[model samples]
Target: MEITLLQGIIITIVIMIIVVDRHLEALFIFRPIIVCPIVGAILGDLNTGLLAGGIVELAFAGIAGIGGASVPEALLTSVMTVVFAHITGNDVATSLALAYPFGVLMQFTWTIRNTAFTAFNAPAERYAKEGNVKGLMKLCFYGIVITMIITGILTFLSVYAAQAPLKAFVEAMPDWVINGFQVAGGLLPAVGFAMLLRVTLKGKYVPYLLAGFLFATFIQIDNVLPVAIMGVAFALMEYYRSGEKEPVTIKGGEESGI
Candidate 1:
């Protein structure tokens, strides 16, 4: 539960790298599913980290930043949730509900950062017009570096400085309040999936969805691997069927083929 100084430093560095990756939109490692396990490993609680990551990933699966719209911060959510769960020895659900506010706070910070970065546009244009490649590169680099540093500091503070207070807050909460958070956290993933289905589901896929639901709900499988395998098989079948060409028929008879 106690996060050492070295662990905090490592986590900060990891966060900085993730933030850079996010800005670059490269590798896609900023997702909770990826980052949570890594943070957990650093904290010597890989299993809890993985569990938290999976839940948080599903909960945020349908949420994305489109155009100027802001979404919850997955990186902060993943980090804080894992840290809190490990620190408090609480369920991932409770940790997720608690850590979500940090995600919102970081989202607001991200919006502000983006707005401020617009100030660099004029200088960037001047550097481009003057063919000062170094200057332009420096301008861009500075923005990324500043973002990394700020995010790292915030993450460090949230995990290190805020841990005691957060743990105290959780301890002070009533059983009903904690239970409510757990329930809400458990439902979030379903809500996220529904949001995704709303946008992507088609009439043709209804059967598959129903089948999956039945298998998952009634079949009482130990894990989802079998269902996933069935899905893969169905997908392959669909792919091959779609690729098959239908036989072409002539308008008249074979005698008219001359």
Candidate 2:
């Protein structure tokens, strides 16, 4: 599906909002899983958007930012991957594999944005010295605006210009390599889960984790929601069981004093 000018403008607006607006949980809205579908809807292909979103979301799920560090540029990558997949008639995996370079490119943009913001420090300090609270607020607001403009422009160009080049690249790829990407795409989510487990797994949760693995692997439960429901049930049972009062023991078989 080709992105029209109006659609491009809408998407640019959406990307800007997702990238810059965080006061109202913008991060949640813009996560690959959510943003991909919005992009797909813009391009008139919801299924491809949803598929690409879910795949990319899982693949990068464990890689969140730590302190001042950066995580994978999931927002932009998800948008581009879904756009590429929709336009090229390619599988979600192929689009995912192809989207990595853009993520790296976004990293550079992120660093540049941070560095650019430092230029505001002197002006901010001057405003503070003069007790111009409004000036400081305006400075911060403009900084955000500039950042959003930059993000919107990049997102527009990436989605609008990527269509032709991605099509050519996919067309020229060998069958074996394409198949390899598909397999890799299928397996990459597991790596994300492993990364997540590295940070989150504990001895107490291991049994529940093992049970989930058994349910999925042995029972062939491919859908995740059912496993999640089972986990919730287990947690509730544990909560109630932990709250139960221990049986009181009578001393010397004598009547307890009231």
Candidate 3:
């Protein structure tokens, strides 16, 4: 699949914006939930984009760069999956499998980016020592620009140059191997859930967890929003309950005095 000039430009711009948002604003516009639709719209396939995005979002939900360590990158993964699905007319599972390597590659890129940014710290420290706020700000701005350029170039190369080889590789794989990829893709979300549980599971929160599981698994809620709303209500109740103070009881040993 060939990306036209206009498509390439749009994708590049989106990639740059996502990178800047990640580094500077951190407003989550770069998140798969938001970015997938935009990429789909660019490629004239919003439904596929949304589907791919949702799957990636769920699968990568627990992935975060915690304690200054880089995790598997999500933005590039989302972009690659949506674009692959859109161009090749593949299902979400296949897209996810194909994009996994790209995500790992981006983890490396993220670490390198951070390392590059760290180099400027010496200058920043010097500026700080001199009380030169403007110099420090300039260094920060330089880092932002470099980040955008690096991400943009990486994204463009992935979209434009790598697709043909990737498509060929997938086509050449045996049926069992391809199916294996799909199966792995389907199971990857469990990893995300396990990670999330590690952080959020606690004795006090078990009942709400059970409630949500029952609602989704047994009743088979058609839409997830209602279950999310129910969760919010439960959370609010727990919050208010925690705020309540126990009543004080005084021993009754004396008669009333006028």
Candidate 4:
């Protein structure tokens, strides 16, 4: 599927919006789960977009930019995965495996951008000291605009310009290699979940986790909606139970200060 200029422009604009929103930490739509579907809609392949998004979302579930730690670029990976899958007619797993390198590349780019942006700190401080509101506003505006433009341009080039080469590379690969990618991609979500559990799992939560696993594994259902609802119900019950106050007991089993 060849991407037209108009579609490329629209996708670029959407990427710009997502990137700016990510920087502002507003709306929280920068995640792969949200970004991929939107891009897929634009590309006229919502199913592939949804599939790619879900897999990538779970794979990166435990990963986040905490404090000074660096994380892979989820937005770029999602966009490229959807685009590559749609254009090359590849499986979601293979697309995800292929798109991961792009995410790492963008991660490096992000680090460089952050380092470069430090130069603006001096100007920002000077404007603050001089009480120049307009100057400060202009600086912020320029910073956002530059970020938006750079992200948009890079996304466009990656999606449009590299499509042919990427498609060729995928086509040239052997069946075993493709299968290996599928295997790796399929394991990534489980690894991500394990990482999350390592951090958040507790003794009290083990039972609930086991129950969920049983429900998901032993009981075959059309969807996981029932299991999800059960989880929510348990969570609500625990919340309310925790909020209740225990009755006070006196020496003779009588309430104190009654």
Candidate 5:
């Protein structure tokens, strides 16, 4: 009943695919951290599940969906964090032993999946020409479903396959390895930040970005909750500032039109 890495991975995959395929909702809850704990709950490790999920969530605080892609690879991080957490006594920092690498691996998979989806869109357009909205949706839906299912299965199976190595690594890891992982923890935030830059960044928004970063780092805004407040405030200020009517200058530098 204690969800092993293999079973946890398996369940997480199924849930992830369902969310990704059916909902098209950014795969948020079905993410690795949430999925892990739910699996753990089913497996009688509720505490472990919750703890693992919380830790991964913090580490992935900056993760965001930009039109579609997410940076620092939330999916892989969530999944692997729970798995490693399960293996390593629910110590959040320790989970990074595999979570970071797993995230990188998932990034490759996601890029490949999206590329295939883009390619499929062309054929889907042909189907769309024939009044086949259903067909087009099917193309996108089934394609995503298939990809999710395959990744889910492979993730679970790979967990099992890698279990021995994971155990060995955890056991034999030098203190430096642990130290390195902890240090890697600080750097992980940069990944999400960089990815966010790629997604929401624009030329005029630099001040807001810097402000949010400063508030978060220096002003002690904790978690997504406070950040959301600050973001909303920032947005309101920007909106009103930009919405203010500007005066039109005439040839003599005087306002002409009201």
Candidate 6:
């Protein structure tokens, strides 16, 4: 089945049909796992979306936010990569490059949504002051709904719009441009690492960080199985050392310590 360009765009738009996670109290259309495949399947390129998504997922698998700081925006990156890949004939690496910038840009979108929610916070505060459960309910629902709906619509629209310019841009550029982008792609992990370092670069953990990175970069132990093994080994060793206990023994009414 041939996928018309407009149909591709519409498929991207369907990403806006978001389902809320009642447990988390946050809004998103779908998990990246779900979203990426859908994008690819719609574009008649599910394999491409899955592959690119797998790369993107692994790259940021360790990312998380602590103490109200920012985290790498995976959702935006995933969406952009899928849309851009579809537009650019689904080049995996190129989709990565296109998605990377959007992640950075989406950080600002994060700020905006957070800032808008701040206003809603004030109303919630007022409700608390007045003991208005209904007010709180209204504020929470409105905040979550409005933010998510706006986010979905905007993501769908921007990604849909971005397709044309991205296609045109790729088509117009010389091969050298893509080559340069590829060279940059080799360096892209540094950005994720730098963001990671902001949190993980403790004096005590520096050696572990260096060792893990070296193993990943030099020894090529980055695949899931090897990394998992290393992680389990590290955890076990740490536990053994930390769980050391004094030995106690008693023989024939005499107590002895080894």
Q: Which candidate wins on lDDT?
A: 1
The best candidate in terms of TM-score: 3
> How many residue pairs clash (N, CA or C atoms closer than 3 angstroms) in each of the candidate models, in the order given?
0, 0, 0, 0, 2, 0
Model 2 C-alpha lDDT per residue in residues 116-139, reported as the tens digit of each score? 889999999999999999999899
Q: Assess candidate 6 and give its TM-score to the true structure.
A: 0.75
Q: Which ten residues in a row have the lowest lDDT in candidate 6?
A: 249-258
> What's model 3's overall lDDT?
0.82
Task: In angstroms, give how far residue 88 of model 3 lies from its true place.
Answer: 2.2
Model 5 lDDT per residue over 1-258, tens place: 134665655565655554473236654575546765775565566776677676666566657555675455655566566666666663656675457787677667777767776778778879978988888878867876767775776566545567667767776878788778767765665765665566567656777777777878877644667878978998898789868885674434232221
**TM-score of every prediction relative to native:** 0.88, 0.84, 0.89, 0.88, 0.69, 0.75
lDDT of 6 by residue, 1-258 (tens): 234657645664464453234113266334456667777777777897797677666555455444545765666677777777667664666667767777767667767777767777777888999999999888767765765676666566557655666678777878888777666655665666666676556555666666676778777553657756776888798789768873563433222211
Following a full C-alpha superposition, what root-mean-square deviation does model 1 have from the true structure? 7.2
Tens digits of per-residue lDDT, candidate 4, 165-215, equal 888888899999888888888887786787678676776678788989899
Per-residue lDDT, model 6, residue 33, is: 60
What C-alpha lDDT values do all the predictions have? Answer: 0.88, 0.80, 0.82, 0.85, 0.64, 0.64
TM-score of 2: 0.84
Candidate 5 lDDT at 131 equals 87
| Top-down TM-score ranking | 3, 1, 4, 2, 6, 5
With a 3 Å backbone cut-off (N, CA, C), the pairs that clash in candidate 6 are none
The worst-scoring run of ten residues by lDDT in candidate 4 lies at 249-258
TM-score, model 5 to reference: 0.69
The window of 10 residues in a row where model 1 has the poorest summed lDDT is 249-258
Write the residue-wise lDDT of candidate 1 on 128-219 in tens digits: 99999999999989999999998998899998878889888888999999889888889888867976787667766777888888889988
Instruction: Report the Cα lDDT for residue 3, model 4.
Output: 74
Q: Model 6 scores what on Cα lDDT?
A: 0.64
